[model samples]
Target: MQNSTRKRQKEELNYLRDKVQSLEKELETKRHQLMASKGEDKENKAVRVQLRGSRARAMRWQRIAKHQLVEKQRAEMQNLQLKESLMDQIKLARSLQKLLKKNASKKVEGTEAAQLQARLEFGNYCSAASEDSLYESLLRDMDAVYAEVDTVCARHPVMQNMEEGSDVSSLLEGETDALSLEATNSKVVPFGMEETCAAVWRCLSKDHVKLADGTYHSVASSPDCIRAKAITTLRVNTTTARMQMRFAMKKYVEPGRVVITLESASESEGPRDLLHGLKMMQRAWVVIRPVPFEPEDNEFDGDLPSEETIIQLCMRLTPSVSATVLDIPGQRAGAITELLLAAVHRNLGWLFQTVENILMEHDFGATLL
Candidate 1:
């Protein structure tokens, strides 16, 4: 009986061992599954991080694009505003000219009637239409007109007499030499900056001269003395095609000042565009200096010396619009230069007369007429 009891106990122990083994295997399987789940979670986290990074980059680029677009639009709007203001100024100036002409026959200066007329004129000019169709028409026909002028000049020997007697080139060379000498002297006189500027302005502003072409000319002197400035403008072909040209001048009546310059350029809508559409042309201006002046009899105003001035006259031709596009097709450069020079010569007499009248009023002791 004892042997049978012992055998039964052994059998029970074996069954218990098998049960423990099965539990160990089940734990191992669970451990493997947990490890695999942890790996998948890590991969998902990494993918989320990559998506976040891409979204951030896209947003950054979008912001940069938006900023550039806003800046471009702002610049374009500013340009439009500037153009509008310029148009308004031009209209007002034209009206003022007309009013002055109407009152030319009577004594209007410093009078109540003159002041009233000015007020009326200002109002009219301010209300004038901004459309520049009249000006545009003139610009369109510049080429034809230029050609006709050239033909007429060739036919008439107007400059022929001057060419035969004293050629322009020799005269220009001599003047250039004199100007160089005047520029070097240091112990020179100084013109009262304020007085000189005022005088120049008055000379330009008060005169009205009618030209042969039926266009009127007027010079307006700037009131600002520190910046002595004057503008001489010509109005022509108003009925057919309104056109204008301005010669702007700046003067500083101080010693040791050299190198005065004057510039003229073709307005893009006018002669510039007429020459070539793909490329526009421009004109350059020459420098004009005041003829140097010195007081007679070795006079000195205390520490200040008398004023000195130098005068120079030159004409220039260059591309108006494009620096590189200077070639005028079908016309040699020489021929074009000659044509322009002749055009200027034709109007030279009128210019001299205008300057003479202004100088006589100021008693500058010089005359161009």
Candidate 2:
């Protein structure tokens, strides 16, 4: 029994050793799995860190884009305000010019009227002169007056149709016949003739009669015939009277005309104001564009600015200069002022075109990008 029990114990010890070996194998497998899981966890943490960095970069870019948009909007608003201010200044200038024109008209009226009266007096003197030498001198003076009148009339818009070359002869001939007939039929009664004798003569003269084509006709000088014959023909009245008189006095008479001269600080001032105003408007347009690009800096942006904008800006500037002139007290009157203003405006238009071409080229490149 002792030998059997020892054999059984030995078997039990072998089984225990086997169990321990199996348990060691399981523990080794479980250890390897845990280490692999820890390695995977470490790799996951690295990938998450990379993702977070990428998201931060995206957020930064979005912020930059928003900031640029805000800046562009602010610039556009400022440009609009500047444009409105310029328009207001232009309006005020126009009002000043109107007031000046009214005042100038009133001041010049008396001077123009006095000049007309003096011309009339000179014409009377020429008419009264009887001597040939006096007549020749008067004729020369009259010619000068007529020349002045012609110049004044040329400046007038309404009387433009009454130019020097129009045919006055046709107008005069149309009224000549009536005047001649009147002269022929009118009898000059002796100034001292008694009223009783004149009445008897008229009655006796009226009784005369005549025959024509088998019909009895009045041969006596009837009142109707006398009256009809006494009236002057149109042709005679026009040619021998009014036209002849006009032709005779034309050399010594003044024609109706007036001269205009610009006088004011606005007119006398240089084109600097116009140039400045134009530049301001151009800059304003640039700022308001979707992309603010300076063509002057880089000649490749193809933004073509409208020519009408430049032209309108120049027109606005012109009246402003005129207004400045009106504001100036005791300004001289001369055509030079108007000529200068026109010259400046023309120069500015040329400049605008040149600048526009340059800006267009610049804006085109920027827009393409």
Candidate 3:
């Protein structure tokens, strides 16, 4: 009985030892699986962190691009506003010229009428001079405006073409049409006085003394010498195309015939001569044609001259006729003012249209991108 009991105890101990060994093997397998799963989780976390960093970089670049775009747009808007202001000034000058013409026209039979006419004429001259000065000021303003535009355009690199996942060059390749237009329209002052004088002389009638060097020595002892000088000087710095044609077409005529003649003289020639001529003409016109002129019965016949005919007449004539028929200073002033204002309007329209087309092209490109 004692031996049987000892055998049973030995069997039980062996069975317990086997069970413990099995549990240990199972625990080891579970630990290996858990370690593998933890390694995989860690790898996934690392990948997720890298993805988050890439997304942040992309977002940062996008914000920078958006800021640049906004700044560019704001600058364009400011330029447009400045251009509009210049247009407004031109319009105001036209209005003032018209008022002066009307005031000068009422027949001055009595002292009161004469005094009123004189006062109105004086006011007209002052206003016209003021307008002219303003126009000259705009020339300076235009340079500054164009410079600003160039600076902005240079700083902000416009996207000519965009691509996805391509290595974009730091300095994008792009081109602009602004330079083409500027090159074509750039004002060049005539090099020689003889060339300028000849151009002016050809526009005047044969009866009108042909001037040498833009200064006509009056053989005809008429008070109209000053008047003639004013008219000649006004047209002196006209564009070669316009000068060749002589008379301003409906398209070219400005209000009050205030032709802003631009001469491109270098510092060597000195601005003195050109400025002196301009001052003399301005003074003469202001003094002589203080009021706007009225159209005479003979001036506008049933057989109205066509634009081409008028242009030819101006070219063929000894001296170009001032648009205003008024013998009085004020009336001529008013008429010329109307003619010049029309020119300003035409030029502004042209400039605006060109700029708008460029912007539209950019917008289209952006849409494609």
In TM-score terms, which candidate is top? 1
lDDT of 2 by residue, 73-158 (tens): 56655444334323332332233333333323333224433433443443343344443443344334433443443343333332
Whole-model lDDT for model 1 versus the true structure?
A: 0.32
Q: Per-candidate TM vs. native?
A: 0.28, 0.18, 0.20
Q: Give each model's whole-structure lDDT.
A: 0.32, 0.27, 0.28
Candidate 1 residue-wise lDDT, 1-369, digit = tens:
223222333433343344334435554554565466558657855754564457688678557756855775565454443343233223322322232233233332344333334334323422235324323332343344333322332323322121211112111112111100001001111333333334334544544554433233333444421111122222221212112343333333334322222322222222331222111111211122233344553564455445433222333222111222333332111122212222233333344345446544555554433
Off by over 4 Å in 1: 1-200, 206-221, 224-247, 256-261, 267-310, 319-339, 362-369
294: Cα error in model 2, Å: 23
Q: Which residue segments of model 3 deviate by more than 4 Å?
A: 1-56, 59-71, 74-76, 79-87, 90-94, 108-280, 283-369
Candidate 2 or 1, higher lDDT: 1
**Candidate 2 global TM-score:** 0.18
Give a tens-digit lDDT track for model 3, residues 38-144: 58657855754565457688688667757865775575554454444344434434333333333334333453333334434333432334433433432343333
